[model samples]
Target chain A: MTWAAVLLLAAGTYALRLAGPMLRRRITLPEAAVRYCGLGAVVLLAAFIATSTMIDGTRLVGPTRPAAVAVGAILALRRAPFIVVVCGAAVTAAVLRLAGLP
Target chain B: MRLIRRTVVLVRGAGLLRDVIAVASAVGVVGASFGAMAAAAGVAPELTIGMSLLVFAGGAQFLAVGVIGAGGGIAAAILAGLLLNARHLPFGLAVGAAFDRGWATRIVGSHLMIDESVAFALAQREPERRRRAYWMCGIAVFVCWNLGTALGVLAGGAVGDPNVLGLDAAFPAGLLALLLPSLADRVALRVALIGATIAVVATPLLQPGAGLLLALIALAFALPLPARRPGRRP
Candidate 1:
């Protein structure tokens, strides 16, 4: 199942990437459609982030994870480098968990 | 032909090459994190490495692995990955000119069409520079990302528990970081907030992937309303 998913995703993503270059002359996406597609991607990602940070296997996790993620989000907003944001989150979570916040 | 000749001469400088390397190295760090997180979540190293090589989209790959690691069904993982990569359609359009030379180049270049490469390509004013930047960034990122993933898999094997090190938090954090730039747009921000709220609310009530999938409803809010009737009152 995992293999199937991976392969399917690979094929699908490749097609999307190729579509514009290959089909640009044949068809053009409406401006509104294009904007919506970008918006939809952001929505999906936001939902994923919320779920992952706040839930664990259908159960709500302690506040520590969310707090750590908040730290990461703040850094990201400030244009901190990727590594810094990641490390900041990890360190925050680790320290919080260690301090018995979990 | 003249442009090609000029491109060859311009390529002699190491300035762009250095810039590409810097960007690739930064991307490599994220790639390593993805590999490590996937392995720690019990994903096979082969699959982790395969994703880095094939998917080549950092955000989608991470989301797919995260979904699967959370026991979300394979179908859900695929769906999420596809949804996250939908932006590539516009990306392909924006940089399509860089890959128009030949069928082989087009096919290979399409596979390498990623956010960073497209951004780099678009930043250049000249057509030749755009093509060069696209290929250089794409190729560099591909190599560095794969190498980082391999190294990460090795390191992940040695780590005892991801949660203890707070590595579990890193996944969501990385994801949020990626999503931040998109949120800068007001409409996108509203949509994301609604979508996230729906997902969080529905999570415990639905199956593993269902909640996240449900978030698609939020996109309805983003749709352009029917052309306002010409005579409609304000």
Candidate 2:
């Protein structure tokens, strides 16, 4: 079942890769769609990030995980460069560990 | 013959070799995050690096790692994670149109047409600039990614108790950082705010992937709400 899932995922992703170039002309999305497209990219990226970080193993690891998230958010707001963003996350995580939170 | 020269130039511009640093900057963080996650999970450091080398998709890597860490079947994790990546299809298609297709060019373009590269290419108003940006970003990502994987994996291995260091934060924080620059509009802001908040609030209620998927759908179907006119100055 798992292999089946992974293969399905891979094929689905490949389809997306193939689709981008194949249908470039046929679709004429409205201005709203276009704007949303820009937003969608960021929005989706955030949603993905949220899921990946806050919830692990179907439970929220509040102290360590959320702290890391807050650190990332702070770094992002400060417009810290990418390396700084990573460092903030690392430090948040390190603090969590030092506090003995899972 | 003029067109041939242009296409060659376009392809060269789009491929990863020319602007290696830009690509690395974009792909490196994501690659490192995945590399570190894999390392933490008792995945052979080689496999972690290989994910960057081979998979190159951060969401998919996250999915694969989450599943693996839980001892979920490898195959299942691969599949679920991939479902999230399906969005790339339309993104790639959008990019593929900018270039006239030939067998080799099409194939290569498809391989390189990731979200960042494609968006960057499409964002370019000029045909040649579009092509060049696309290729450069893609190639940069590919090259930097493979190299960065080694760094991340080694870093992961060297850190004692990778969990304590909060290495997992790299993936989300890195991605969030990549995403922030792109959110420069109002409708996008609203929808993103709505969708993101929904995801955060509803985190307790839904699967992470499914919750996010739902947010995308809600944002997409949010037609009944007033549509903001362009240049209207919200």
Candidate 3:
């Protein structure tokens, strides 16, 4: 049932995308509004990421995950590529494994 | 030949892979975060990948997964996801106006619409540049994003706890990446800051539904007052 729901929602998302150009004549947003819309996307993305990482499902925070912390830090300071961060975090994690540090 | 053209267009539309990966790790963290939610929700990890492949919108998918974890009906979850993604309409139209290609190309370009994809496309001033860059960014995001979701799911399924690696902390860092660039001037900065402030205060007060409402309200307050810029080209 839920899978069906997921699929339907996916289609709905694509539908919204498809409908945009089709209705370009009917609906118009100001350029500023449009630009802010773009910024808003980034803001929402930021908001989503921020709140999720801060709070576990039912708790405020969880136990340590230093390697993931390393990944986030590297991303921030260096603005390093995503692959580097993922790889670094994963490798950092793998190293901890090799060092018996969970 | 045209298929390849479309493929190049897609690749070029995404920012270079270097740039894509620059954003991908943070996205990966998001994916892992969602994976944790999905795992806890008892949704199969593979289904999460399928959601990425099909829906491909991170925010919507994240919200839906979050809802599912909280025992919301699938219907309500889908409805909320659609509402959140409603902003894509204006996004696609903006890209459409800026697109100087034929109708076929415009239609095709519309399919690539997403948060970052539209932003990247509009950031460019040239037509071919816009097309190629937008497609490349969108495609790159598609590849990394879906793959990252899969990786997260795989990790989640095997690992007992998401916190073992401190993935919880990845959010602010990731959001920071998204927020820093859009602070184009004082207004944008104020808007973002105020929105963040509102989000922090509202998160615990509202359920997921109400929190999104608060985010939208905060976003509206932060956004310019909907007055069109005087000199923008049609």
Candidate 4:
């Protein structure tokens, strides 16, 4: 089941990637559609970050996870490199979790 | 004179070369964490490696595994992963013009069009240099990322409790880092904020992945009607 899901996602993603090259000439997007695409990118990314940090399946994670995510977010907004941002956030969460903050 | 000209060309491309290495190493480390987390979540080591190899998008893969590991359905995991990757359409479009002619190259190039490669390619102003950076960074990231995932799978069992090390936090942090640059645009910032609000609100009411999908509806506000021409009768 997991493998099938992975494969379906991969295939769909690849088609979307390929659509730009193969379909650009064949189909020109409407002005509104293009704008939506641009905005959709930002919105979807934001949604991903929120969902991953705040939601665990159907349940919400405890404050520690969200707090650690905030640390990462601040660093990221300040333009920290990928490694520092990821590790810094991880360490914050680890420390909090170690302290038994649920 | 010829040698000096060759040296100059090399010097010009050096920044992108350095950037490729930096991106590779950075992504590689995250890839390792992803493997460790997946393994810790009880996903088999082989499947973890396979996910890295096939999906190749770090954020989407992490989201998928997070959902699946949390006992979410497979369809939910797939939907979340695809939604996270929807940005690749624009990314591929941005860099599509940089590809050389040939079905083999195009197919392979399109397959490798992840965030790093697309960003590195578009950062270059010159077409030739952009293509070079694209291929260089694309191949470098692919190899390094997969290798890192394999290593992480091998070490995953030993790294018990991925959350203890805050690996869970790493997923959101990495995503935020990617979103940081785009947020500088006021429109993007507004859209993101609105989307985040929707996701937060919907999380409790809707299913796990549905909240994120609901956020895409925020893009409706970004749509604009075509402007009229100067002499239009309307």
Candidate 5:
């Protein structure tokens, strides 16, 4: 089942990635869709971030994960290097969790 | 003469090459994190490595692991991966012009059209330079990412406990970092904020993965109305 899921996803993702580069000239999206293409990534990332940080098995995870992620986001917004963002988030969560905060 | 041309191209692209190395190193480290996360989720090291190798998209792989580990079902995990990677379509379109026109080139290039490669290619001024930068960054990322994943898997067994290091939080944090630049655009920022709110609110109401999938609806505002023809009435 895992292999099936992984292979299917790999195939689908490959097709999506190839669609524009191979078909850009031959195919054009609707003007409405084209206009929003750039924002799709931002929306996807945002949604994923929220879902991952906050949700677990239909229940909200503890606040530490979200708080840690916020720290990383703020640093990233400030244009800190990627390494700093990663380390800062991990440290924040570790500290928060160590304080016995659920 | 062929070798000389290659050397000249390499020398001319030295600065871009340095930047590419820096980005690749960063990506490699993230790849290591993904591997560690996968291991912590109880995935076999081999399969974890396989996920990174085949999926290739960092965000999608992390989402896949997150969903799968949470008992979200295989179908839901696959769907999430697809949605997470859907952004690659626009990336392909944006960088399509940089790829040399040939069946083999397009096939290979499309496989390598990740965020960094496309961004690097588009930053170049000339078509030839763009192609070079694309291939350079793409190959570098591919090699480094896989290598890092392997290293992490080997180390993951020893560091079975990821929480002590807060690796659990790293996934969302890393993704947020990636999202920051896009938030600079006012429209994108609004869409993202709305999407995030929807996802967070919907998490408990919907099935696993649905929250994020439904959040895509927030992008409706970005869609333009049909172009009105100058002399046409609706």
Candidate 6:
């Protein structure tokens, strides 16, 4: 099942990546559609971040993870390097958990 | 005049290579986290590495692993990944000229069409410089990212439960970082907020990946309203 998912995703994503270049002269996407596609990606990513950070399966993982993620978000907004943002979140979560924050 | 221009481009290319390496290193770090998180989530080492090798899109790979790890079905995982990667369509268009050499280059270049590589390519004004930036960044990132993932998978095996060290938090954190830049646009921010709210609210009620799918409803808000009623007077 996992292999199938990976293969499908790989194929589909590659197609999308290839579509624009391959069809550039053959077709032109509507301006609105293009803009929406960009916006849609942002929406999906935000949604994913929220659910993954706050909920695990059907249960809320509690505040520790969210708090750590918050730190990472702030660092990212400030344009911190990717490594710092990641390590900062991990460290914050580990420290909070160590202090019994759950 | 042509020879002088070529010399200048070559000189600039040297500096661009340095910048591309720095960006590639950052991508490598995130790639490592992805490998470790996926492995810790009980993904087979081979599968984790395979996804990194083949999929190569950090956001999509991370989303797929997260969905599957939460017990979502394979269909949901693939769907989520495809949705996250939708941006690559425009990306390919914007950088198409970089791959104009031939079909062979196009196939491999499409596979290398990542956010950072495209960004680096677009930043250059000259077509020659742009092509150089694209290939240099793409190859550098590919090599570093794969190496990093391999190292991370090995490290993940040595480590015990990922949660103890908060490695689990790293996935969401990395995702949040990715989303941050896009949030700068006002409409995108509003849509993101709405989408996030829907996902959070629907999470408990719906199955794991279903809630994330439901968030697509937020795009309705992003769509432009119909034609301003055929140009009525303001």
**Model 6: per-residue Cα lDDT over B1-234, one tens digit each:** 999998987777676776666567656766777778888888888888888888898868877888887788788889878876776775676678776577888889999988667655655557887788789989999988888788788888553455667766776776566556567767888888999999999978876657776887998887663443477976
Residues B64-91, model 1: lDDT tens digits? 8878777887888888788767667756
For candidate 6, the per-residue lDDT at B158 reads 55
Clashing pairs in 5: none
Native contacts recovered, each model:
0.77, 0.55, 0.37, 0.72, 0.75, 0.73
Candidate 4 pairs with clashing backbones? none
What is the DockQ score, from 0 to 1, of model 1?
0.47
- Model 2 chain B poorest ten-residue lDDT run: B14-23
Tell me what TM-score chain A of model 6 achieves: 0.71
Interface RMSD of each: 5.1, 4.3, 4.7, 3.9, 3.8, 4.8
Residue by residue across B1-234, what tens digits does model 4's lDDT show?
Answer: 999999999987775576567567766777777888887888887788888888888877887888777788898888877865766776555567677356787788888888667655645668898799789988999998899899888887564555777877876776677567667766778788889889988977876556777887777655453343546875
Please, what is the TM-score per model? 0.60, 0.66, 0.63, 0.70, 0.68, 0.62
Instruction: Indicate the residue-level lDDT of B210 in model 3.
Output: 40
Question: In terms of DockQ, which candidate is stronger, 1 or 5?
Answer: 5
Q: Pick the candidate with the highest TM-score.
A: 4
Q: Score the docking of each candidate (DockQ).
A: 0.47, 0.38, 0.31, 0.50, 0.49, 0.48
What TM value does model 6 have? Answer: 0.62
Query: 4 or 6: which has the higher DockQ?
Result: 4
Chain A only TM-scores, each candidate in turn: 0.70, 0.74, 0.56, 0.74, 0.71, 0.71
Candidate 1 clash pair list? none
Off by over 4 Å in 2: A1-9, B1-54, B65-75, B93-106, B112-137, B144-165, B201-207, B220-234
The CAPRI-style docking tier of model 5 reads: medium
Sort by DockQ, top down from the best:
4, 5, 6, 1, 2, 3
Range of the 10 consecutive residues with the lowest summed lDDT in candidate 5 chain B: B221-230
DockQ versus reference, model 6: 0.48
lDDT of each: 0.77, 0.63, 0.60, 0.75, 0.75, 0.77
